[model samples]
Target: MKANKAAVLTVAEKCKNILASNWQCHLSTIKADAKGSKGEIYTSKVKYIVKRGKPYVWVPESDAHNVNAIIDERGSLAITTPFPGPLAHLLKSVQKLPSRIALTGDVVLLKEKKAQLATEKLEALILSEQKAVNELSYTVRGVLSSTNPVFTSRSENLQGLTDGGENYNIYKFDLRSCTYLSGTGGTHEIDLGELQTSKADSLAPYSAMLIDGINQSESRRRALVLFCFTYLNARVKDAYILSLDRKGTDVLGKVPNPTSNEQFQWKEFRFTFKEEAPDVEALCCQLVEMEEEAIKKVSSYSGLG
Candidate 1:
């Protein structure tokens, strides 16, 4: 586990969440010449699904990368989380980079039964996200539908992706080594076993909705900024939850320049939960408690009854 324990997730867990959250990845393979000596590397953007912590992708049988991968099973995948849905506003800062992972692995073609399973997993992933988005608040749904390309571009074309059947070849990426780049935590090398044993954050699917709701609510936003000011000792001009997991919340704060009030800079801060929340209900309760604690601390600091 290369990730710091104080952080919300381990490097491996973050890798799992990132893989589960996004469908598109850059697939890199080596094309060998007639003598199979030095080869040319080719990278192609392709849709993918993560099943059991392994990435699976499908491409037309004749695709150059596919053909290259067939000749040499060694390949790699670079995946990054898509633009966050309605909460994009919170992550607009340059400090708020995307979570990404680069995986070096053996890309082996899946046969009959394995291919069927991989295909089904891809279909299920698309359907599950659609259903989950549908259950979100109307505002989040509307914003996601219009502004988020991840959903807007793929939702309608999902059927076409899997319908290619015989024309597409399914391949599973067997992880050899992984490197995780945390948006704020820097980069770390993750072991294969560590990644294979870890699970995606339980709150991953609902993170956008939860963060967006807090950002949209005046009281919640006020409480969050106040918490940063009072507890974290941050001179915050404004603050919002950048991301959330069962382990904690990452807050992005805008602070006015010490020399010039008109100028501001962005900084990221982490607040780990006392205990991991098991579900949305528990997470909400923890957030409420945090808000209450912040309010109380603010009142005490100001000597107000």
Candidate 2:
């Protein structure tokens, strides 16, 4: 093996595969299928990486981020796995390499199947978790789809620190009408379900974080359950709310918790729900209103209007 046959073969096959099937590597050359009506195309610099003893090559950059997703989304393909070379050695051994390796149709098909399977698995996990969280909180809160929630300007493609587009707008509803009892209160306050309660039932497997406020003997006392996504992003996951009884409860975990007095002190978390996007001043004003709403909900069950 002049140059480590195993590694070289692996890399060669990968480069060949990239040259064969992937859309990113479909180069425009003097060869056939290289010309459109005008006959010119942009060049792409696609590369491969070798880690440990294995070599892997797929799409690069943004395309790579969603490469598998693209393949799996197509229903006709009915993919069950991802492309083979990118897989670990165990899976690599199981693959039945294509009869015509140059064309790379078999590898492409495998990639498609892998993507499809991964997509299905992710979807199933999310749905199952959602159902569990939803059912658990049905009696205490409401979770609404964040697709186009309220008046927040949504841009799915934009990546920013303040952007919430990638995340669905989660809203919590506590029909009790008391602001504090409705989680953060205010229209902007979405339900995280019942994240706090006696830990006796065992919510450890739920994927989201739990809140355990101190209490004499209520088992779980108070809690502010959050969705899985929120649980993972907390720099300081802390939440605080005051019940209508004026019992002050604060949750200190990942994100900042809402604050309120125990009795007659709950204002709502205000949100700007408008037909058009709010200006900076308007957004601030809306948040003010949201806080007021939260206050009202927490302070008086009858003052929701």
Question: Candidate 1: what lDDT?
Answer: 0.72
How would you encode candidate 2's per-residue C-alpha lDDT over 1-305 as one tens digit per residue?
Answer: 01223212222222222222211122111112323122232223332221221112233333322333233211111101112211223223433221111111111222455544433443453455445545543322211121121111111111121232232111111121111111222222212232121111112121011211111112222122221112222232222221110011123232333563332221222111322212222322332343454445444645544
Clashing pairs in 1: none
Give the Å error, residue 66, model 2.
Answer: 8.8
Candidate 1 lDDT by residue in tens digits, 1-305: 11257646777887887776566789989976555625678888877767777788877676787667657889999987555543465566364667789999898998899898877876887687666656755544432333333343344335567665547888888888999987766989998888889998755655555666666566676777887876678878777777677887777788877789699877777887877887655677777788788888888878993
Residue 103 in candidate 2 has what lDDT? Answer: 14
Off by over 4 Å in 2: 1-110, 137-305
Which segments of model 1 are wrong by more than 4 Å?
Answer: 1-7, 32-38, 60-62, 85-96, 126-160, 163-167, 208-223, 258-262, 292-305
What RMSD does model 1 have?
Answer: 4.7
